[model samples]
Target: MSVAAADPDFATRLNAFDLAALVYEDGIAIDRLMVDFARGLAEAGRRVGGIAQLPPGPATEPGQVDLIDLMTGDIRPLKQRLGPGAASCTLDGSALAAASTGIRRAVAAQVDLVVISKFSKQEIAGGGFRAEFAAAVEAGLPVLTSVKRSQIGGWLAFTGGLGTLLDGRMDILVDWWAETERRRAKTRHRHVS
Candidate 1:
């Protein structure tokens, strides 16, 4: 609001241009939002330190990581709040490889609950419904999209809450990926030694 209006330049960016009008004129759906979220994450690579809030699961020890990466917010605290089927892993099999690989794998594996708090509503706005919806329908899983639109700016005029309502059920493969990644890392370390 008022802050943007105070800045004539911002006013032009919003009203003088058609960006704001287009988003409001046309209501937003779910699919498009997912696509946009993915794109942003790619662009934001290595920046979002990832929320280390670790959703509950079998207790596992932490690992040695690059001091720089940890300091740079490249590694956020693990996410908390585990569901009946939730699990967490360091995404490292051994002491070497980074954690992101395992995280991605887990997401693709179809676990009941994948807790990736890195995404927002706008990112997926451009993504179509059928593609994302199909996954949920097929797996019978639910998607709990989390976002913080309160302080966001620019052409992304989002409408709705931080989360989305996806019909049908689905699964998150987080546990599988975590297990695989940990195993791989350990195997690699043993081979090296």
Candidate 2:
């Protein structure tokens, strides 16, 4: 994956901010970090939208979790139970479809930022939230998402080098959001003038 050097002002130059995958080392709580970051932005009065993953349940059941709708605290299950093991579980495409509907609404509503929980195996394989991601980008909406180190290749190719990889830092994300808002405001002002 091509790592772009952190450019603090990069968001200011673009109408839409397509974030680079937030790469974290093994054992890092990247999911939780993303949840907290999205919450922080919303609490700070930014009109954040899209989905953030809810933490997985206890270890007795791995890979079982729901995604939270950022605008509404609705839960969408990620996998359907088939049996006891990881192999028993299969992705719940219906749930994803429901969530995608919400994302499309969010984009149409022009939310300030869109937080896709992750660019995962499904997305890389041309499934999952890939369509929602494309819709958000097509609408020129700023998007933030986490990408596993292993899946960075697909993420890079999918974003076509337009994404900025962040180091999972809350401050850095906040800076990008601020710059994006600034750019949006400037664009609005220019249109009015």
lDDT of all predictions: 0.30, 0.75
Per residue, candidate 2 scores C-alpha lDDT tens digits across 1-193 of: 1112233443354443545468766687887888888888789988878888776657526667788889887887777987765564487878788788778878988898888888888887878788888777767778888887887888877765676788777777777767777877887899999
- Deviation (Å) of 61 in candidate 1: 19
The C-alpha stretches of model 2 lying farther than 4 A from their native spots are 1-20, 57-61, 85-89
Per-prediction TM-score? 0.23, 0.82
lDDT of 2 at 156: 77
Q: Backbone clashes per model, in order?
A: 43, 2
- Positional deviation of 68 in candidate 2, in angstroms? 0.4
- Can you write out model 1's per-residue Cα lDDT over 1-193, one digit (the tens) per residue? 1223334454332211111111111233322333233334336551222112222234533332221122123543332334446477542333112334333333355433322332333234533121332232233222323333332332123322212222211212223323434654675599899
lDDT of 2 at 117: 85
* Deviation from native of the Cα of residue 13 in model 1, angstroms: 36
Give the least accurate 10-residue stretch of model 1, judged by summed lDDT.
16-25
Top-scoring candidate (lDDT): 2
State how far residue 10 of model 2 sits from its true place (Å): 17
Q: Mind sharing the TM-score for model 1?
A: 0.23
